[model samples]
Target: MGLIDHLKARLGPARGKVSDLAQQHGDKVQHGLDKAAKAVDEKTKGKYSNRIHTGTDKAKGAMDRLAHKDEPGTEGGGGSGGGDMFTPPRTPPPTS
Candidate 1:
């Protein structure tokens, strides 16, 4: 098989496992993401608050897409493997 095909073959099961985990424990995963971001923000003394917020939001959006992959009306806008639901993106902080 070609390299891309070989990699996809190897990673296919992993993607399914991730989708299953995302399905089962998505909330906990998102919570952990938030907690980790908060810790990082605290350590940085809020200096990167904007970036941190943006990153956290992106992470959460990916998680949401993963958790809603198979549901109706979410195709082409979610994880290629699976998904749960949609969430509106948070507004980015205005830069000076």
Candidate 2:
């Protein structure tokens, strides 16, 4: 096997463990993100509110991805390479 495959084989269990921890504590992680975002937003006096919100959303989404990454048959589970690129749209595309 190639180096990448070898490394993945070695680290697969550890990655699964990490994913389990993330799933168990996802709410705490999200709470921390919210607290930090609020602090930054307050300090900036809402000047960067939009940017902060976007970042916060991205962070939460990442946490969701991590937490759900190990479920059997779900997208992002070990095996298929198609999970990372497919996500349902959260909002309708803007009309011209």
Candidate 3:
């Protein structure tokens, strides 16, 4: 196997553990992101509210992806060496 494959083999457990943790603590992580964004918005007197909100949403989406990275049928199977098909839903644009 190549170096990348070797590393993946070695780190598979760690990656799974991280994904589990992310799934378990996803809400807390998203909450912290929101809190930080709120603080920044406050500091900036709401001048950057739109940008901050957009960023916060993006961050939450990333967290969700990470948390679900190891879920079965999502892009790759759940460590079972089987290929399962899963597609994420697209988010609609925010309405004014």
Clashing pairs in 2: none
How close to the true structure is residue 52 of candidate 1, measured as C-alpha lDDT? 93
Q: Candidate 1: what lDDT?
A: 0.79
Models sorted by lDDT, best on top: 2, 1, 3
Please report the TM-score between candidate 3 and the true structure. 0.65
User: What lDDT tens digits, residue by residue, belong to model 1 across residues 3-65?
Assistant: 999999999989878878889999999999999999999999999998899788878878877
* Model 2 TM-score, 2 decimals: 0.70
Which lDDT tens digits does candidate 3 get at residues 47-96? Answer: 98987987787677667777777666754445433222233454776799
Write down the RMSD of all candidates, one decimal each: 5.4, 6.2, 7.3
- Candidate 3: list runs displaced more than 4 Å: 76-96
Candidate 2, residues 1-96, lDDT tens digits: the string is 699999999999998888898899999999999999999999999998987997788778777777877666656344344433355555754699
Comparison by TM-score, 1 against 2, better one:
1
lDDT of 2 at 47: 95
